[model samples]
Target chain A: MSGEGWVAVVGTGPAGPEWLTPETAGILEQATDLVGYGPYLDRVAAGHQRRHASDNREELARAGHALDLAAEGAKVAVVSGGDPGVFAMGAAVLEAVDRDTAGRWRDVEVTVHPGVSAMQAAAARLGAPLGADFCAISLSDNLKPLAVVERRVRLAAEAGLVMALYNPASRARPWQLGRVLEVLGEVHPPQTPVIFATAAGRGDQERLTVTTLAEADPARADMRTLVLVGIPATRVLQRPDGTLRVYTPRYYEEAE
Target chain B: MSGEGWVAVVGTGPAGPEWLTPETAGILEQATDLVGYGPYLDRVAAGHQRRHASDNREELARAGHALDLAAEGAKVAVVSGGDPGVFAMGAAVLEAVDRDTAGRWRDVEVTVHPGVSAMQAAAARLGAPLGADFCAISLSDNLKPLAVVERRVRLAAEAGLVMALYNPASRARPWQLGRVLEVLGEVHPPQTPVIFATAAGRGDQERLTVTTLAEADPARADMRTLVLVGIPATRVLQRPDGTLRVYTPRYYEEAE
Candidate 1:
């Protein structure tokens, strides 16, 4: 393994070409190898760079492979969908580096670059529902216990913070979203607004549904969805055309 | 007031030109007026567009002015540092639109474009400290009460969520950061890693400091700084050159 190579973990920011930042594009342009999940790797334009596509659940393996290639003098770019640092490949790459027992990749310079996150994209589509203090929780119980997820949702709701829930539902675990909504219902008011944004930033596939806590159905969400639950200060307004816009007020009325 | 105008609220993503997205740049190119705080408005390249810069504390007025410009048949872009949807100008603009009486600007279309947020930028610099669930809390009590901020911190800390603290301190509110630290100390371990990233994404002014909760000083942070508090799964590693990197592991050991 040589010390001449480096690895950069970058995010494409959802699924649009317009969302890619110049910094990430620069790294992608200079990379000798690109590694990521199949769909995310497909986002980049086909070029001379060697592609290492893998399953979505194989983040650690992919990270280790990228590090090994970088240690062997290959400039590698690990691609992710949203911001690499937020529930993405950046941590997986670092975890691989930490587990490098032989220290072979010590000289391989690793850098993580920022990108727009799913929550940010969803919030933008919904007109700034997360304009105040907000929490991002992954509803997947694969990494943490459901009890912990429930407790965090309840606490965040009680604190009156807007909540952005990612990985709301998967085929394997179908009941997580219902439980989350149940926990949210116990803390927030029935009229609290909820937003379901699916495939945001992915033109043509984007869909947004706005409802309230009492009427928000868990069936409206899937793995591709990002759900936002509002606090008491959140408002829902209707346009003349009957479209609804939701936003959380920057200031609390009673706080003043 | 006319129906032929629109306003796009876009974020510049902390600082630096590379952080600006193509989507935001396209909007900026077509805008007839740019409305935002003086520093944020200064980010755009001066052109034929009219500048409507205001004080940092006057987000609502700035937003209303932007709406007025749009209603008068001008294309306006409201610039914010980092994602406008996240505690920036996006919500303020929506609030102003909602408060518009007599519906003078009813036909004025408003949209928010997502940008890299300060937390995402800071986490990238610190090597993915926000890999899992995280919360963004603005320490400034100008909008909400200090009690509300403190309660949210305690609940978020207790939930084991990595926290990104924004506006940690200001000239007039020096005690909020200390109180946040005191509350965090009660829930998190003393050895928990804390990161201070100032002026992130700004080419020459970016600075990062790594320390533990027990040793972290509130004075090290300012309004331009973003502070990250890690969970038990977070780790700090050193390269052969003695440079440090911090990251929270993607998977919890006990969860499996």
Candidate 2:
């Protein structure tokens, strides 16, 4: 097996060590080379693997380097925080492989290793807000236009689907999340449940807040946070002990 | 912690034991009661834990029962085959807890443990169909109306979003998958990439087939299969060794 080339795109899942899956850990252990954003690469156990850590914007370049190494018969692993397929490196790696015109790069074996996505962590933390048909749209207009982003938000709301908004806000684009909230307010009621969970399941830094859309402050969210907006059927309950929980019902109303 | 009422909703991820996460495994090992569909409960290691396995159609009843066990101060674990939050039991449990009205159920603490969702497993197996903006809709009209399913399919295609379709077809509903495929053909080219993966990541009985929209047959998919349809940006590449791969580019196109 060593004679051929292979690359594993692995998701590190939640930030805490315990959240790491055994399958992903085992795949990283066998990696001869690890490539990813610096912090994600650091998550791989320090060993014989040569690390090619880079900045966040270098995903395409990093994927190329991983593919190049794999083509040379090295066992390469491209590490991405959370699930690689969801707004992560899996897409970049596959894009690189798909666009590779040379036969050498095409023959390199590639596989994506599934891990728990950040949305899953947020949903787990704040009860299940995504219990029905849903859509995930990145509010970041870095690649797509903001107009397109705005349209998707409206269309998703019109469809009454629970939505997970990725890249809701960054320091540079603090107003991005507010715009979506405004569109949501037009369609959903003020009491519609919205959850902001930052660095969820990451031990101490994690912060979870369940609130109504009207009460949700975009300033409370940053890059680390994932915002979940529930449909009209979503409900928030305050327990007798003052703790709050939110959930979307599995059944949609129909003619009985 | 032992005296307090608590329940852990665990997602068993893919079909095999090796795909199981350590955290979920540890929680299941400590459970005093296991509740889920019969097949899901069977995945739990048999021991002292009392099993309350039921049929698939009884999700709400099962969730209520799990909460009942937790309210009785038992270490209960409700296992879902995939990520509990994604069209599964996580919402059911939370909804049951929130609407109990008797107030006895609200105090039964619940936590959802994130695991790899079935869509993630399918995306991993077939490169990255979900690398960009995506939506997941259950094609099973058992709960929601079939018209809602058909409308969402058209709208999702109109939005140019990749789609992950769950419960595409069942033995009783053999014609359902065909309907969605027909809608997909209307919006997409006949050569649009489509993937059908059944019992993914399972050691055996796992099947993966990649075909275009025109070539795909609904007969190939069943209840266990997940269908992935790519957007316009998606591509299919044939390697020198003749293996086919499909992926969506991470970079969203800008108006030139």
Candidate 3:
């Protein structure tokens, strides 16, 4: 597909402008219009030559605006932190473009440029917590029913898959992660390795704590937090000086 | 930690030298000794001021050598592709430095700089398969046991977590991922979305077909291939032109 008038869904990496991949930066620089949650657009350095539509509450509207602009033959960039295809705006963009009124927007090229997710950034800091089979689920029931979230948590725990919890808690959903733990407790032991990482890669980044499922306190978590729960085989080794690291034992390595 | 004889663990991003994060590049430029797997060393285009230890095998040996050099006051940079800490030699360096023979190296400072992981690279090209709660498991049983692999696979599948399968198959371990599919079939449906991504960032990069669990052929997979399996909640939407895109339902946004 020709690249002109395309909608580029770009992942800006974890934090800061430097983490943005070259491909993402190039799309942002070349786009005629920019659309995203407000904070993400703010992440781009000043003096980029793109018009902006930044609104956190009206995501669908923003996505529609980007698609409308792209349909009008304007190159647009929908910015996301991490990757657009994950939980970000890539799907929303596609949905907006595919709507009956803007069916022609479908012909406009779409490209997704990936960025590092918070789970990865946190895993990178701690060690290879994600080296083995894992699962990522947001504890918030803002959209899905609590029953569904519980079911996924219980099943994932029973499977002994490492779990990355996104949107664990917000002001309105403060007890979400705690509720997830309550469900997970039914299958996973209390000693499961749990790592809570917040604001990973940002200058104001704080809070990298290693604890067990029983010890995890959702009160300390926030929207910025990314919680990682390891399976039964996962272990947290503490150094003599008190630094803790997490690893999932493959067990096969020892068979040799 | 003063930048003096400290070691910095850097990631080379996807492929191009420009893809390297500035912080990672700066660390390489400032280091007095470079230590990493041989293939990774070749990716760094910038010239380093000091010596380097490069090899195809012997990751642990390279870490020991780097730490020994750092003990003698050499500023070291231990490098890896994507991120040093993901599945790379960063942990090996840490383990080696923490050993008793590394008494001098213990006092040496260490910093881990994050980079793009292969999963992220693949997810970027395909939309956001890695954004939701996903598990990444290396199919290679060299350092891990097949039982552990089966357990994790079962758990991840049962939890309805998306999966990024690494080291899916190699010359000697050709049947590993195929066996993993058999384990997954017990829990997951046969029609789950599976993506095979290869050579993510390079010019020759290719993202192959998305098929169902029942139709997946592990024989076609290799060490360089990154396989992504979508969860039950994931939907593969087909465009009017017959193009398919995979996405997971985040539920919360829909409620809003």
Candidate 4:
């Protein structure tokens, strides 16, 4: 268990196997050990790859373990549900690398492989809500202060940015999303289109709802949901089958 | 040729066939007709599918052509390089859907299948430059005014957001990216990490450069390049192999 050590951070994309990019899949297939949250680890097609699953909040520990294993000559795959770089395991691993003063972890070969992001998949399911200059903001506030999240939300909304909010709500933080809606309501009209897309591409387990900002029920969004808030240029088309297709136009008209 | 109308917008990621997501690949394979920019359409593995390739700026016409074909019972796919929704074809198709007053184009069953966005792939290649909350802004300013792009870029920089700037430079638009760097320089330190990733994942044509805001050579980037600007929190780890890995931490440390 002692040779050139390396770690690959992989994104599975929206909690399904088909979303795996070829590069990410290649890394996962060659992984001697896979580490991630329990739920995300379950989504990997682990063909004899040892699982190092941990709880949701144990990100740092999981990252350290992955780095340590890689340093011991293990081909480790630290998996994230969406794009690993987007508020996911890639950050945690890099943080561990920076802080590991006792080990030769800095020399460990680490790479991040891109995967389909939840916001990307969610926007796709709703047609194309992220068509304009958009921002992806994680509302969890676990990594930063709540005030900072609110400040960013307000600035983004004021800048006419269509936004995709990740980690909108969890059992421990159910009110943050509602607060975000309140902030958005101050700048955007109540008629602004918002989409609550959950478990996109998850087959039979998927749920999608399109509503106006005033009508959006924040309670409907759990940890799995990605909430897309549209800019003023966003439009919703009605299908013959009575479904709604939300998309932002590519061209932006000068604001009156 | 008359039946129910349908259109699927697909993303062929990073100018490489291997980056095609399974969902997007399936749509292209099943398409009776494929429509897109001349280069992007060429990437689709269209086996006997009718191709409706158009010049890059003819997005609306290409979208209209796809809709017309779909209206005639053809399973049509409007293709784009990178993610369709990110400064590409999805928004144009949606705009066409919204503006089509004469035909029943609004009723067509249109779906967007997400692909690995150029920013995502480029960030992966640079080792997670977008590891935290970030925004993607297209610097073309052809669709919108340069003032608007500058305003957003300034706001993003002032808010300490890591930014992925799409269409940063082109033969026709060489100075805009330099102007953007100037604006970012006003708010951020000249030492901020910047990545110039071009033709990412595109076989031997690929190139990657990591530099700082002060040293960033805007001339090195063209339309095919993706520019990622790091926030103050972004860290660069220099490997023994003489390469640098830039990543923004998951948790933001409180500024003194």
Write down the worst ten-residue block by lDDT for model 2 chain A: A247-256
- For model 1, the local distance difference test gives 0.86
Predicted model with the maximum TM-score: 1
| Sort by lDDT, top down from the best | 1, 4, 2, 3
lDDT of 3 by residue, B56-106 (tens): 467667877777777678888888887665667666666655454636666
Q: Candidate 2's residue-wise lDDT over B161-198, tens digit each?
A: 78899988855567878988899899888888889999
Which segments of candidate 1 are over 4 A away from where they belong? A1-3, B1-3, B253-256
**TM-score-based ranking:** 1, 4, 2, 3
- Model 2: interface root-mean-square deviation in Å: 1.5
Report the lDDT tens digits of candidate 4 across residue range A155-242.
Answer: 8887778999988985556788888899999889899999998888888989999998899999989777899999877899887778
DockQ result, candidate 1: 0.82
Q: Give residue B192's lDDT in candidate 1 (0 to 100).
A: 88
lDDT of the candidates, in the order given: 0.86, 0.82, 0.70, 0.83
After superposition, the stretches of candidate 3 with alpha carbons farther than 4 Å from their true spots are A1-3, A48-50, A97-102, A126-132, A183-193, A231-256, B49-56, B98-104, B205-207, B237-244, B252-256
Provide interface RMSD per model, one decimal: 1.1, 1.5, 3.3, 1.4
DockQ of predicted model 2? 0.71
The residue-level lDDT of candidate 1 at A56 comes to 85
Off by over 4 Å in 4: A1-4, A170-173, B1-5, B170-173
Q: In CAPRI terms, where does candidate 4 land?
A: medium
State the lDDT at A194 in candidate 2.
90
Q: How would you encode candidate 1's per-residue C-alpha lDDT over A1-256 as one tens digit per residue?
A: 1237888999999878788898998889888999998898899846889999998887888999999999898999999998899889999999999988888888889989999889889889878999988888887647777877888788888777789998888556688898899899988778889999999978789999988899999999977999999987888878766667788887766631
Clash pairs detected, candidate 2: none
